[model samples]
Target: MTDRDAFVARLGGVFEHSPWVAERAYDRAAATGLTAGTVHSALCQAFRTALPREKMQVLRAHPDLAGKLAIAGKLTADSTAEQASAGLDRLTPEEHERFTALNDTYTKKFGFPFIIAVKGLTKGQILASFQSRIDNSPEEEFETACAQVEKIARLRLQSMIPGDENA
Candidate 1:
């Protein structure tokens, strides 16, 4: 079969599980070429990391503070049914108010929600980074955002295997 066809077939397997996850890599694949073989190899080459560099790029591209659809856990109490995991979640009603204000300001300034992979971080940790990054120049934050997204994407890619891969 053609290389693009192989990549498409492979992508079909990966994306079937989570469109969000698949979108990240598939977009990269599409940009490189419609083929499965080249795109997969390109992704591995570009990402260059153990998991794949393209995956990281994909993860970093996500919009944080999603409506109720986040495949990831909630960083805030606003959309979650459970207590917010980040220390920001523990904010008093007043603190919560301020957190929202800051989040709003940050979002307005950046064009996307403040994103951080909350897997290993606590509220305090996320807050510290958030507060610090809030003052970051757009260029700096953009790179930082990309870096974080890359990490998240790598994690997701690792979660998917080649064959038993999701739909």
Candidate 2:
């Protein structure tokens, strides 16, 4: 594969359902160099500068944490693994019910599923964040959600990029 194609293939899904971020980031890589730092910066810049509607689509593309898609085995492999890492896959019935309720409430409030990087958090921590953010204004929530999305993408990139600490 060409270098660009290989780069995209490796990092395309870092931004949830957004492959376009990786594609644009690859285009920017020519000027910035292909190191992990530049790749991440380009990817976030593409996401940051996206039209508001496109940003909404990206946010909406994310599955609700431990919600229907996850229960039905329809989450992307990355999402499934990330959720599992946070103990979301092991929730009790009570915890599941709480997540379901909060997810519904949050989506109603913000028009997008609640999203947080679940890599190192426990289910309790995720639930707490959900509860806390549900009270944010739409504008505040949008910014917070977008920032969380970038954090998720950064964590994903770090896993795939070797010697990332130095980049």
- Candidate 1 residue lDDT tens string, 1-167: 76555544554333212233333455566675544353444444444442434444443334343222333453322224222434433556665555567668887887656767555576667667778999998767766765654444343344433332221
Clashing pairs in 2: none
TM-score of each candidate structure, all chains considered together: 0.51, 0.94
Could you give me the TM-score of model 2 versus the true structure? 0.94
Q: Tens digit of lDDT per residue, candidate 2, span 1-167?
A: 99888888888888888888888878887587777787889999999999998899889999999889999999999899999999898899999999999999999989999989999898878888888889999999999999999988878777777677543
Candidate 1: list runs displaced more than 4 Å.
1-61, 66-98, 162-167
Candidate 2: how many backbone clashes? Answer: 0
Instruction: Score each candidate by Cα lDDT.
Output: 0.50, 0.88
